[model samples]
Target: METQEANTKKVVVEKKPLEKVCIICAKGSLEDVYATLVMANGAVMEGIETNVFFTFFGLDGITKKQMNRLHTATTGNPAMRMPGGIPFPTMLGGLPGVETAVSGMMRKQMEELDMPPVDEFLEMITAGGGTIYACKLAIDMFKLEKKDLSDEVEDIITIGQFYELCDGDRTQIIFT
Candidate 1:
């Protein structure tokens, strides 16, 4: 009896069960876009089904003109930080190309950490069964056409549609 109990206790623990994640991206800036991407990647890594919904300013992330030209936050974002704990000046960020430069640096940092670029990251997620959707309201408000969206996007969906996708699972809704 004691031997049987010991054997039972020796069983290795399993990782957490896979959960479904619904990520909402509401901002168009590089930081916000990266935040959404990172979370999606994490969910994928943890064997979870993930869906990303881009709405409002967040739609810029998937737009044809701005996807790769995202800008970094210099001011008005309390989380913005420079190298070695330095705080970036809000004025500098307003200068032309500063945001682009900062965005490039952040991308490089991610690359150094062996993380994939946003484009390929989205590709990986979709290829791995994750889903991406653009917001209908945003597209209409911005006068955007389907042709203006990135090829990686799955479709343009309404808020109601997004809710429908979240149904019937232990789904977690997160807005970044």
Candidate 2:
């Protein structure tokens, strides 16, 4: 019995930690955009290989004309709070200019913490050995060319290609 237990213990394999992470950003809202950025940055900081694929409206976060001007999603966002510590009313979110105001407030708060803007964040991530990819289907659907994206975008690729990038024994895929 002791010999049999020893042989079974040798057959058990030790699991290794994740070595790579692939993040998919599919929403355009400020919160959604920041969530991807934070996770990708954190992964790179831990010496894990990181790649972020921006699809659908999330492409706005990497677009040159809209990167720094992205807006918050106030409607249906229960977590939103006003600057004065009051909860943001859902009805108020529909009023004209309310989204702009909320976006500005969110920007101000991020700035207060010395967080980089979207464009700068992309740069930082790329500089830290992370990669940014734009969805080819979204680019074609939106009639966007390569020039429409920020310079930090490493490539425009399909979902299949994105999967290939994450192909490995311990690659994690996260959708934001």
Candidate 3:
């Protein structure tokens, strides 16, 4: 005979919500940038302290000249496909105009889904009290001035300063 109490043992664990989120954006492609933005935005919406740091090629998302003109990388993307789910040929993806057309289609699809433009998305995130930062090392390497970045950028800081913000028992550091 088996005892029901023994078979149905109870387990208790501590429940805690994330208090802060530090997200790092290191890629420049449209999809990657959007992924970072979406996560940061979602965290802000949840009333969590959100800090977004853009570095390397990801600076394109905050660069005033390129923010609105970001494009998706169709070539070498294994999951890239046509509108109806047909697999896109890698060779065709590398052809002239194909990348642009595909990126345009992607942006169009996002727009149809009511997604905001990069600049507007940044604005929304900031409006929600989320902080945006540019990596100082990347800025120096790219020869970019603070004025070249989007107004939404709160500051340019070193990775060390960024890590300082990651301190907290309930903080999450996300590298996207």
Tell me which residue pairs clash in candidate 1. Answer: none
Worst 10 residues of 3 by lDDT: 5-14
TM-score of every prediction relative to native: 0.83, 0.89, 0.92
Q: Give a tens-digit lDDT track for model 3, residues 117-165.
A: 9999999999999999999999999999999999999999999999999
Estimate, for each residue in 1-176, the C-alpha lDDT of model 2 and write its tens digit: 99999999988967798899999999988888999998998899899999999999999999999989999878898888887779989999989999998898889989899888999989989999999999999999999999999999999999999989998989999999
Between the candidate structures 1 and 3, which one is better when assessed by TM-score? 3
Which 10-residue window in model 1 sums to the lowest lDDT?
Answer: 9-18
As for candidate 2, its clashing pairs are none
Estimate the Cα RMSD of every predicted model relative to the unseen true structure.
Answer: 3.8, 2.7, 2.6
> Alpha carbon lDDT of residue 42, candidate 2?
87
Candidate 2 — worst ten consecutive residues by lDDT sum?
76-85
**Predictions in order: lDDT:** 0.86, 0.93, 0.94
Model 1, runs deviating above 4 Å: 1-18
Between candidates 1 and 2, name the one with more favorable lDDT: 2
Q: Where does candidate 3 clash, by residue pair?
A: none
Predicted candidate 1 versus true structure: per-residue lDDT over 1-176, tens digit per residue? 99988888777555656589999999988878989988997898788989999999999888888887777676576677788988877887788887778888988887899877667777877887888999999999999988998888999999999998887557889999
